[model samples]
Target chain A: MHPLAAVRGVPRRTWLRWRFAYLVLLPTLILFTYLRVFPTAWAFVMSFFEWGLVKPAERFVGFDNYTTLLSDKNFTTALLNTTIFAFATTIFSVILAIALAAVLARVVRGRTGGLLELLYFAPVLVPMVPVTLGWREIFNYNHGVLNAFLGIFGITRVPWLSDPNMALVAVIILSVWKQVGYNMIILIVGMRAIPRVYEEAAAVDGASAWQRFRHVTMPLLAPVTLFVIVITTIASYNVFTQVYVLASDVQGAPGRLVPVIVYDLFQNGFRFFKMGYASAEAVYLFLIILVLTLIQFRFLRGSRA
Target chain B: MNLRRRGMSRVGYWILVAVLALGGIAMIFPIFWLFSVSFRPASEINTVPPNLLPVHWTLNNFTVVFQRAPMLSYLWNSFVFATISTIFIVLTSSTAGYIFAKFKFPGNNAIFMLVLATAIVPFEIYMVPLFLQMNALHLVNNPIGLFLPFLVLSYGIFFMRQNTMTSVPDEILDAARIDGMSETGVMIRMVPRLLAPAVSALAILAFIQAWTAFIWPLLILNDPKYFPMELGLSQFANTGSSNFGVTSAAAVIALLPSIIAFLLLRRRIVEGITITGLQG
Candidate 1:
């Protein structure tokens, strides 16, 4: 017998040592193959061809979809819109979260943590549809509370959702409002994990609140900050539900945002039975997201390193 | 503890509380508005002058919501899908988590790295391919379409591994094995009790993810019969009906399960996020 195989019961036979491990991993592998790998492979294959829902035969069109996407007007616009939405949401949500987290860390005592967390957490649990519908009501030009609030200061109705120019901004605000609480919770935990010793040390050196925050708190929160930024950005890029609900269609009057364009493509591809075009559009979106995600991961990795 | 900063700290804490309270209200105001609107009469919605409070409060909207569409059916669909997916996630992840934590196996690190790598890939790319795969298998518009793909959660496995490795001591596991417990027996009998909290936390996350899942279900489930509440809500909202009250009511119904679940499981949810955030 091999020296390694001399174990009495617990197998020194390395492979036999973990039948349970294989058993455990079996379902996960099967599920991933069916759900993730199979689809991902199929999509990759489909990307290389011109095919749709109804086409009798798929024409092999290598790189055509990729090249065409680069030139498509709607694709460009959607790209821009997606960028704007993601950038705006990420900046505002992160700032708001950091601000709220700082305050929550400093001011709230006792049950304050629980209370603030609960309140912020409410929006997360509330279904997106209701939240979007509520925003629609609030952004209703004539009777909307937002306009009503602005009217109090003798300001004119801002056409919150009506004007395409302001529509994107309105959508961004809704996204931030829905998400800020989540970021706050995460940020607060980050802030809390920074020990009291740092604050005490800073105070001993006569460092003011702003000084301590800038030097002590912010630096220690590097990981959480990166997490918040990456998640928010990725999520913003995938900002479909809010946009679909708020803006309704892709052609936002004279112009459309990237996701709206994607949705339009989807509508054309699937709804209108233009499968070939929709696949092209999906592939286009895939490439864009892929590039942006790569950039984000690279930047984050580079910064961290 | 410093006497000099005591008063300042107290004042600062109160100020922060007030600000956070206001912010929290701002965050939840839309939800409150949704609730109030749902209770109002049909005529009250889109009124000449909006009523913050309903003129004539009634449950008629709720009644009509059930009557107007297959609201109950949609609710059941969402509940079933969320439940099945969550259960599968918890069970598979826990087992995988146990093996990764307790057993020293070759390629463990490599396997974990592979699983974690998928986390960064935006799921949008996989969406269409997944649909096509389902179509190929004739699973389109099927409930299994929602549950099957979602079952293999890399994050769940990672989470379970992280939790078990940290929480389950090797001694207890070794003792279980010495006591004639099979490896599977050790996992089933011993590991679960130790990993209950992590399991619940994962369950909450899985539930929310599955419940709020929009795009996947939207793509796969074209049949109205399998329409989850979120999609159903959108369909109702877009029907161009003047009954905003009922629409709002249906929205509320759709949202209630998650809201209630979150409220019930807020502690677990908060702990899960905080723990994951800290560890990461």
Candidate 2:
């Protein structure tokens, strides 16, 4: 340490401190760089080549994979279907969550409210595989509880998983049911974080409950609401498990009927071994999310001011 | 005017309560249905008019599920994977978080930002190359492969760093250092004790994630012996006789650990989500 201190005008104390810090951080940094950072960079590189599992060598095809994606019917269908699913789920889930959180905020001091919160959050805790398995039965055409309940009103059995549009709707319904409570809880926390004095002051100034909420509560909630929207949208765009289990078949057929981005990527990469094309699709997904995140940052900065 | 307004507001409040109760019922009905179907006799499961509750409850489905698959093995695998991975995550996250929060070193913010950047990128994007890398390393089809991708979570580091900043005091650490305690010793003994609540919360989150992870496991493991509960259940549902009752039983088995965990540690789980905005 004394020799090091003499070498470059560095003190031994600072050197020792730096050494300890680095030693502590070494394991995490090494794992992240190897497992996460390297692979991400490799994926972007792999996207420019025609890589396959059984091929002897990777053939360089610059921009070819991306161009193929633009023309691929399956890719286009998946992109469109995923877009619809993402927008619908985000809008419905965010609105319902806010409404539920608002009502719960009114009654959250009671035991009933606590129980309700627990019940709602239970789905979010359970794994997606089981949730989708349970829903498959509920969405069954003949023996399902949903159709049976509908039959009470003399409505016919709906082919929930058979028809393409209804199948997508079914996926959307399952997602919203699973996701609403999470957003509601987050929004509730955000609402509780708001200082009460401002609301009390507004009340003293003769503001009605509705007026106070619309003016004071709503503006303060903007940031959290935006956060919920962005997070929900991103999560919805990555929807695969529910669709994989509920809508598609064993070989992932009818993925066409209910085409989604991740399903397409899974089929391409894992099933067909078309690694390069799949990497291109993944890059597209990454770009989409990147844009969304950047937009979130922009809005977040604006809201702060 | 005040009395009339109060009466109207009371009516509105009751209406909202009723709506919330109905929504609560909707939320929990699927779980109730899963249990009911799993316990129902096969003959009663597909009856012309589906009974809301089973007219005759039976354990036949559970027996059939166990007979058809090695469910006990699947549960054991899931438990081990979740437990071990959680330990790694907590150890790495706490040490790294402590360093970032307390130590003022060169490239600290830059390194922390690099870690934070990885948190937002979905795993699906890089999984192809990751799969190849695992194959090259001869880790594919091995249990070690399952733990490789999850060894270091960017989210865990970020969460712990934020918690450490707010919770841990610097004076105590300085005192410990001045008392001739090594940095590693201070970290191993004192830091974890001070951050026990955050550590527990992080542990729960990590445990739940490792327990429920599907996609990566599906890609790495083709051997049934290594199949976690979720993968085992999905395979059974798809390849088995398509018996809804048996499948429901299998699904119930898969969901039990998490449900039990949530029931016991609900407050910590809720507090974790509230603080971290991390959905389990």
Candidate 3:
């Protein structure tokens, strides 16, 4: 009965179903376009101009912002810091998670295992701001618990947050502690999903426990391990809330000492009102993550083959 | 597998337990310190050797936290933002997911792929333009701006689509169609109940994300009255007069809702993360 339906020689029911599908998808598609697609395109365009927040001084800058970023010391620090943070966090968290999952797989049939899993996962549930705050107190130089504990060994208080090098290490430590549990759970699930027959066959072939795990369990877990690494790297590269909360005070690390990419973008975009430069930085961050993700896909496909 | 276990001595098993128990303690000690310090009296907070438990417990820090800032308002704002955004995310994701999974239409796979592609683009990449857009629309500093970017999550769409395909059967939908139920009627009546588990999982994930959001709220909101708990707590800690006890109390209060939610919906949350591969 519909005009298009009759013209296209389609059944009314089929046309109606298509109509219903489009009708259902329309609102979400429109929203996604407006909020996500449009803004992403706009950011690219804005990156090419000298965009500002306060003044109406927007003009085409012809890649000057990108060139300036080459000489910018702060941006360089942030890039280096983010790279270190990402690599350290990913490697440490992934290895520790695999170890924890391996142990738990052997002992996880009962209530005690569940309780331990929950205990490790508890930090993952608590909000980052508060947990970072708790870590800040522990990392405090004087009269803090960590310092007090170290004093027992007659090791003088280490300024965990104040020194630039130590501050990065402290951030990495916090990140690993918060993230290991989540990866552990994922790896545990991955380990469980491995059919037991392979391990059984290996054992029957006179493979020792270590030998079976090295060959059988490890190979199967490659995909999940790669997944954890990729996601952790991406997440770590976007680390902001912890750095912002932890380094903005006198008691905590100085922001300049613990510079990260998102913090750089936030500072440039919001604090200094340098929208154009910030967009360029955002594009750079996007490219790094994009490349990382593409590498992951390639690696995943390789492993599957 | 049993043979492998049989080779291990009893001593090894207990050693493993002891090591894991120690690791668990390390994992939970910071959280324990948070609550312990929060209950300490202000005088005891500055002691040279910090006691793991408060020497004398008092509720004065909580009272101080409430008095210093608009703590109640911050909690309310967070609740409203997280709840409303979660409802919209669940609704949009479920409907979009349902269509993508069940319906045959042109460009279905392409469109779904497009939506999923956006998940890989971090918010930091586009937030500059988004801020300008919000500013142009006069939404900055408004509560609506706090959650505008989050109302439609790409991950939620992918998650819901995967769930709908796995759980919702084609026969049931065809039967409903034959029963003369309008597509909208079928969706309204049956899809939600059928997809209840996935819906709850997505809802809790979205809620926790919105509730814990900080940087966007910090960027969009300047008014103290509009601050979410994250922003509020940050500001509280930044104030020069803030002390250890009071600040810890504020942090504890900000963390309470998530702790409560995690405890009540542990299995669902865990299941959701495992399925979706969502990191906190």
Candidate 4:
């Protein structure tokens, strides 16, 4: 104590070291508090009040908004559509990605792997607006590429975006087109990481490649598969661009996913000045996502156990 | 044994190639068409027999887009905003990533978990209030308005943190401490080289996020003059009644920078995607 008391003044070096991390973290904390946490809290509070976009007054409406949303047929249909979109895309994409990645992992050598990956990943870089425009042209009934190609096989032209019966499928195709590459790359990496020793051991024991893969690789890749399923499902549920572009008219008028519902709310809330209803809708969509994510977490936990 | 294995492998290779070749064409044909239609005269875009390839390529469409829409202005706006936003993101996330990776600070685990938790919340949900906050701060319609919110990415932080935690060994930090390097000095000098992969990945992700940021900017910026490329492209699409050619051309212009950027940094982009997806 006597020796340390003699050196009363701490060095500038120690002073700077003490505050370095906080200096880095302080701005981030403030930013997140303002942008992320505040918005979420405001959205929640706003859900309980009837407010106008332009007006300052917010009347406490309590549970009426929730009741109204529950009775709204459009809301129910959007919820259903969101569920369908999420499950369908997740299943198809997971299966297709695993199959494609498994195949590519085997044969692609050196430079070809990079080229194939480049081609597959091109869509990720392509912005949503242009991608939607290209899809519109591709899905065009008369002069569209898909119809033109199908004509060679004598199949009748399909009204992809126009027909409500097929509109969901069209959106699904775009979602798959945009996302499958991403999922595939992930799976390919996962497949590559499976030690070659397992395959060689299986081969030595007279196991076929498919059997070896099913027993050894697939089981090992289960965590990756689970991760993809949950993330893709959530992403598909929240899909906005394709729906916003394709169903330009009557977007809120039943039979679209939840994000479309959110978009509709955006228009109504901001554009038409119905802020209360929009906040209510936002909360509803939040609950749906919350429940789905909770289910996914539980599923992952159960699988792990 | 050798012949059978060789034959099987060859057959597998060809089939994979055939399918992927087909799939690749199907994927890239849209991009090809976007370019083809962009250069063709307006009349040729959706003609009776739609042209697969423009007979006479011209800069006329680009010229029209530049004249009709503030395409160049919008592009400039996007470039400035994205560049600034990306720089901040890289700087802040890398530093925070370093802190979380190296130091055993108080509440670190809780903070990390909170950052990770925020990842599950859709970014779109924060738009309205963010707009309100920006308005209160008088940041609306400013480039800083566009740049600031995107600067702090939870995903980037989490990514950098994970990368650092795995690769930046404590022994290295100990050695630096022994050499009397301050923590900031050690981080600044050492982390960047070690964080090449994470930084590259985060940069691409940050660039893409800022570039495609539509709804947030649409809410915050009221002026058409301040619109990013995404909003500009949407404007072109929305005014579909009068100016299909210009709209399509504007779309073409919007496509250029992203595709070009991706081409230039394709490997980094792919690496970034694979890393994020693997961590999924």
Candidate 5:
């Protein structure tokens, strides 16, 4: 209902109090829709048409773009690769984050604890480009830090990002390293919020340390855990700048992770000038995220019930 | 968790702390490596059985970076973009967040939810069309094009709204209104003062986001001088491996300002990031 709905049956001058909210909200709404909403809607509209940057014309192609996308090797690769990336990064990062938070929350307290927490949170500040580039150097096939360290143990140099089998793992590790701290901070706060009474109750019942955490702490931390999963999954699936720097020859070295979605989109839209085709890919990506997010909301609502 | 109350030994406690501390160091090792490699000579950078510390520390890489490109100018481009964008986003997000959190206006929930939904949609979804949109506006080669899309961030608005819900009480606004302050005046004078923490947190986050921005800037701008340092760092990698030392140095320089900003405002960044994570 309108803020003026109650006043609609009355006079306008009598209830003009809340109209300032609309006035203040206009700039943000206008700019946001203009920049974000308009472009997104335009992408959807262009997906069904043969929009080309080269020929400078558009034709209604219906589901042709979609069909073409479904058959594209790069598209299929991206679909599988992105799924693996999302789930792997989310799960691995979440597990490490939980363990770190639980331990730090228990063992460390005081100024030292605070300092350590800050140190843990430090990577969250580093950008994707630097982190990815740095890791690219570290993951180098020869003379890289990791390979050199492994060599110290009498192991041969192992190609990190270059090997097809290890490429996804390398990517996952790169992301997880940057992400764990943010999740740790969140989980720590979540753990801190869980009342000590629950733990005490579990303790009095003769639950061991592991048992108490498994039964009491884990159950109570479900909401935050679910949140972490959804966030990390969404972020991981969209990892582009890192992949661009790591895999593509955009930097000096060619990347081995061939089927990542955003990189595919970049190649299509920018490199190949297939704006319409790329738009279709974008639509699929958007729908996947939308469905995932909706599923999360549904699960949370169900848990509440 | 009061796990200590259950008769865990002091030795075990220190052992756990030491292990966790080691893990912490390991987690940030890449950053430490980046810093260490910044000073390493070209020979030591790719040496087998890599020296943990630089064998021959040199400022030569820094000199190469400066001589090769207008690196500081690139940093200036990034700094200006980050600063200006942060200011605009902070002002815009706070104003909108104040309304969404405090006012019961028409379309409040609907509009707020629309902004919230954008958080889930990655920029790639609309990035092609956005490129065309910028092209239409003749901003493809313009710096404004790089910063425009981020001027009002969804996460900033959402974070500010969450902070406002808890921080700014309605009674104070009412009191301000009663004292003859207009609605806008009340917001400008009182609400912002109260939202200082949220504003600072949002500002730091916005600064970093804009500073580290890559894809859009890479697409939007053409000239090397207009390039942000994030994009500039790519040249080192793209051009060749011979400049590996300077490449690492450039990467360090690119990340330095944001790291400094984050260090100065780690408390706020942590709070801001947590609110985002919690709400998600």
Candidate 6:
């Protein structure tokens, strides 16, 4: 017998039939353990220790790292900012997309909207570093296009990224711009899934277009919107690249209102070399995400009910 | 009813056309501005009345970007990472999908759910420990480090499994088996062609993901030479002057492959999203 056969037990006749399937599945299991299971479990253990990768020692500090996270001002700012950004991005994108889908769905029914799709999906196609940084340049204090446009109106420049109050808003707008198209496409697909027969029945009942949409379309579109909300909220929490590119210069002015949890963890672990502290943040982030997801499920179903 | 309906619908459709047209412009305007900004000379970029169209359109910034930075090297690195990883992803995911679709094995459902559950937690959850793990393995700061995270996309497998379950009928597999083919032989010969659409969609998704990936490469590879296009552009974003045109130019150049891929494989991309929507 092959040395590997020890893992699967003695090959009964029945086991021989399923051997190829297990053989094919070996790579998937190996990758799953390597990439996901091991790392995740390791992160949980590391969260408990005072394990700074920079330092030579890995002290077992117990709950100290987790407790310190409660009072870390930067950590506090990041958590608050992350929550706000996640909520705003998810809600804003979901609403705008459905609204766009509502209009574009009608348009597609009347005519093929291929051109419209290409145009809307441009952002999703375009890489983030460019679009977000490109917006950063446009939002520049002096020579930016937005300021230049405002120069036409004789309005003074607004420090879009530099000003702490405006920085999160700036990041939010750029994110909304990037992801709205993706949500719009998904929702448009959702809109198409709603049978035309229902609309025709509503029309026969002499319901106005607005009434038909309110009474007929909205309820049916709920499931897709919920999916969009969950995905977008998760995406919003993980907003790092755009922040790194756009708001890197914005120091803690209004405080770290735009520097989110991922950004915070990155700085702590990577830049500051505080691995254990960052791992604790990671643990918190995991809990927050798990709790929020559960809450969103309840909220979505509850709202519908 | 016909005349009234015609008038109302015509008005509604035109309103929609205008709305979508304007929204489309908003969507693509930043990229247009990036291209426009990139072509402008340093002085012209700061002109009093900012022209949406570049008055002095030159290849100065792009040329500067290529000359000043190791751009071609970055592109080459990105190309290698994306291509190799994409092939790995498609083959494994499709095979996994095929097995999950066709086979009845112990622990299969448990395994699939574990794969799917990982999709919710972003890489940030485990990235710190992953970094240490890579360091322990001496895989950090290497080219292999850059490609490590994408070794298996959980979502790709999930996407493939869904496609296979619906599309890859068992009749074809049994037909191949009945013809005196071995199991591996049947999988190798027959399954991939049938799963071509899922394969193509995933290829596009995975390639673009690897090509445009920044954080993993940034976190893993400390060496400048191994930096991919997005990380390369980020270097420009930070250390470069406020001239901004050059950085925008670099951004545009870096984005070219993904844009081209999107344009070429537009249908598969849409189909991928449609499947996602239908399942949702």
Model 6 residue A260 CA deviation (Å) reads: 1.1
Ranking by TM-score: 3, 2, 5, 6, 1, 4
The docking quality of candidate 6, as DockQ, is 0.59
lDDT of each: 0.75, 0.86, 0.86, 0.74, 0.82, 0.80
Predicted model with the maximum DockQ: 3
Q: What's the C-alpha lDDT at position B26 in model 5?
A: 84
Q: Where in model 3 is the C-alpha error above 4 Å?
A: A6-9, A54-57, A249-254, B1-4, B278-280
- What TM-score between 0 and 1 does chain B of candidate 6 receive? 0.90
* TM values, all candidates: 0.90, 0.96, 0.96, 0.89, 0.94, 0.92
Model 1, B92-196: lDDT tens per residue?
888877877777776777777877766555566567666666777889888887677778677788888999988999999889888888776887789889999
Fnat for candidate 6 (0 to 1)? 0.67
TM-score of candidate 4 against the unseen true structure:
0.89
Ranking by DockQ: 3, 5, 2, 6, 1, 4
Question: What's the ranking of the predictions by lDDT, best on top?
Answer: 3, 2, 5, 6, 1, 4
Clashing pairs in 6: none
Clashing pairs in 1: A52-A275, A52-A276, A78-A258, A107-B13
lDDT of 2 by residue, A114-202 (tens): 88888777888889898898998999998899998899899999999888889999999999999998999998888888887877787
The TM-score of predicted model 5 comes to 0.94
- What tens digits encode model 3's per-residue C-alpha lDDT throughout A270-303? 8899999999999999999999899888998898
DockQ of each: 0.55, 0.62, 0.70, 0.48, 0.66, 0.59
Poorly placed runs, candidate 6 (over 4 Å)? A1-13, A54-57, A108-112, A150-156, A250-257, A295-305, B1-12, B276-280
The residue-level lDDT of candidate 2 at A154 comes to: 98
Clashing pairs in 2: none
For the predicted complex of model 5, DockQ is: 0.66
Off by over 4 Å in 5: A1-10, A54-57, A249-257, B5-7
Task: For residue A15, give model 5's deviation from the true position in Å.
Answer: 5.5
